[model samples]
Target: MKPGALALVTGANRGIGLETARQLAQRGAVVLLGSRDAVRGEAAARSLDPDGARILPVALDVTDTRSVAALAKRLERDHGRLDVLVNNAGVFVGATAADTTAEVTRDILAVNVVGAVAVMHAMLPLLRRSSAPRVVNVSSTTASFGLTSSGADLAGDASVRLAYTASKAALNMLTVQYDRAFRQDPDLAHIKINSASPGWTATGMNGFRAPRTVREGARAVVTLATLPDEGPSGGFFDEHGQLVW
Candidate 1:
């Protein structure tokens, strides 16, 4: 996405999402700062852009189909096109495999996987209208089957949560699928979709125990979100470069 591009970031009220929105705004993209709570969203938007020119608050609950549709309709009516979409809304439910329940797993998938796809489906039309569109799915190192299955003690001990890891793994798959769809569709070939890992960041999602700062974590998102026309898609990456999926 270029300067002045239109962008929307879900779960932008805080953490990596908030930092990503701020960075996008600094690059001159008009960003819709999405949060489940409208008040908190507005507060976040203000913090990103005090003049209310670059960052705008939006009430978006990815798990709510109606809310997702409503926002898409509003964006279509106002902007008519979306240049960037950052699916950053996710939940962390730390429970070991033995402690994980069906309900908990289902709930995690609903938001982390289904919700991101829902938003993408709703915004496809608007995205198609743009000459160049980018979609970034926020993922995690815990989602990497290579790392986890290999007994790599990466990310952290909190990553043992089956529900959270599984959700992100599914999300990474969805990102690849979406990228494939765009490549196969002639009219949508310009659209790029990639999964980005923020690494372990110190945020509420992890009790702020992680070592990375929000800015450090958001680099991957911003990089892929603003990729040039030649940038790669359907790959998992972080600030460092390509990552194991």
Candidate 2:
């Protein structure tokens, strides 16, 4: 992206989020590492940059409206604008569709779907201030209806967790709708919005079962986050290429 661009990444205490933040910082962006816990967030930021040169940790519990608002306010007061937002914070509770309870589904949606949207909503004003802004929603292949229906590995696995799968599907739609809205608004047309699937990375969310490393999984996210002004929006993509919704 632009030199010294401001970027915020959620769930940055570990896994793909952490890697994404690291990559962004390496590319010269001032990165904000957001975590639900302040202590963990600060530690993660320190681990990435002991001198606190480029990365800053911020306490952000996406499920709480007040916490999201507080983060937005802090960003505005400190930095004035946000150039990139990586909506990577998510939760997974493994249970088959048949065994998944309403409560479990609700909990998953609270983080994976509602929490993502809430953060985006609160950060839009700050994003608009940037000459080129981007919002990358970290999604999954399981979220793709085409892949799931076509029996694509874990995405079509009969034992996949319904709550997690459904929440990601919702997140994909959220990305599409937000992108469309921004594109139609002349004043905000410069904003780029896209959903990215990290391709089954070995993150804590999956109990470290996936084959891909966090660095590999974070590639698509960083690509979308740092997309040029001419890049596509309202699209779903993976490491290989674009995906069907």
lDDT at 58, model 2 = 92
lDDT by residue (tens digit), candidate 2, 50-158: 9999999999999999999999999999989999999999998888768799998989999999999899989999999999999999998888899889877763344
Q: Where in model 1 is the C-alpha error above 4 Å?
A: none
Candidate lDDT (C-alpha), each: 0.92, 0.92
CA lDDT of 155 in candidate 2?
Answer: 31
How close is each model in CA RMSD to the real structure?
Answer: 1.0, 1.2
How does each model score on TM-score? 0.98, 0.97
| Residue-by-residue lDDT tens digits, candidate 1, 40-100 | 9998888778889999999999999999999999999999999999999999888877889
Residue 65 CA displacement from its true place in model 2, Å: 0.8
Q: Which ten residues in a row have the lowest lDDT in candidate 1?
A: 153-162
